[model samples]
Target: MPTTAAESQFDELGSLYEDVVDWPFRRDIELPAVLHSLGDLTRSDVLDFGCGAGLYTRLLAGQGARRVVGYDESEGMLREARHREAKEQRGIEYVSQLTPALAHRFDVVLSVYVLPYVASRDGLRQMCASMARMLRPGGRLLALPLHPDYDPHSDYYTAYGFRLVSESPHVEGSPVRLELRVRGVEADVTAYYWSRGALEEALHGAGFGPVFWAAPWPPGLARIEDAPTVQRAYLRRPHAAMLDCRLARAAE
Candidate 1:
């Protein structure tokens, strides 16, 4: 698979990818919304794009998906995924990239926190097009990209153990770089800041329709009274947003 600068950063942080599971905001807020939006998977042939360490890939298979395949651009991450596959024998296939022959092979494509890494508008377009082509007609695409409204100036991210080392202008097409620390180890990550309008336009151009956004917190989890003051505040300002879309059906 072709490697990009963003993928290179992930490769460097390969060992820490799994640690993301412990991030409370992601574990408690973002991921639950993604899973809730998925609804059912028992009969679906699912594609887990950017399946770092095969976390969700394994979960999908365990959820009784008929078939599950994971694709990631990082060799280091794939190695970890493959190791888990070998030990667990979940019958999941891991690949560095989606092949042309796999076009329209999936009933659902799940990409979590992936698109922001795509540094250019053209790159995002190509990524969306590839995802559209991989799904059968009427297939669903569920993604969680960095929230377009995220404030780099706030201490909100600090609660999650991330600090903004530096950032480009908050203008469209610019990149926001952050430093994440866990157990005294730090990794620098970069992601492109894409406006919500641009993202929706790209999805529609790729033949997805009726796109909708879901808040980071699941239905019952956004209550301010149920959460700590900090968490309640954090819940109001999401770090990521859910994108739910479906491929257009062929005309009868």
Candidate 2:
């Protein structure tokens, strides 16, 4: 059967975001550390922001979470996630990002590769604030933001390969690259490479503390040692700094 136009559009967008590709590389390296950093998440409510295919949500269910909810902006992707539920027979709920009326608070909130799509610095700040707002008191929100160092406006960027560059002491080098796959036409998508420093400030301003830290690919996992054709840094959140807990509150 021929693919529908909607699906085709989605496929293009996915490719732009590297969503069409399998990320066993990232999942293998980051998932364990991300799960471990939660301290004790057993029986806790989990929210998988940008839950592509709900893979993390399903993983959470396997980890003994009392309940899990996956949120994504893509309906096509949600359809695939629903398919997983039927195939694996796992109990998971998928929700639209537009409606928040039935919103449920969570013990842990995590957004993997969701923040950079937000566009502006203000948008990123708003996202952090929203995460803080959704958590219960003392609840943790884990966010993996694309480092700002690899921005196109920066000098460290490469037209074809990845480069590691720094913006400040608080900010470290974010590895970034752009991959041009041969799919008929050349399309370009930019991912903000992340650094440790920028993440802390964003989180602090949003109302969260940094308690743990680890690169998505700390070790064991294959490192794109040469650097990503573009890749961002990983920001670990815990209690390293004070949070503006009221920031998100005031916004509401």
TM-score winner:
1
lDDT of 2 by residue, 1-252 (tens): 111112223333433333323443344445665666554667688788777667677778888887788877677667778777888877888885625552336777777666544534565567666666666667666665553322343333332222323333223332233343333434444434334555567677866665355444434445555434333322222111211122233223
- Give the runs in model 1 whose Cα sits over 4 Å from its true position: 1-4, 164-169, 249-252
Error of 1 at 184 (Å): 1.6
lDDT of 1 at 93: 97
Using all chains and alpha carbons, the TM-scores for the candidates as numbered come to 0.92, 0.62
TM-score of candidate 2 versus the correct structure, residues matched by position: 0.62
Query: Which predicted model would earn the best lDDT?
Result: 1
Report the lDDT tens digits of candidate 1 across residue range 44-134. 9999988988888987887889999999998888888998899989999999878887789999999987888888888888788878888
Runs of candidate 2 exceeding 4 Å displacement: 1-24, 98-104, 147-188, 193-198, 210-212, 217-252
Residue-level error in angstroms, candidate 2, position 12: 5.4
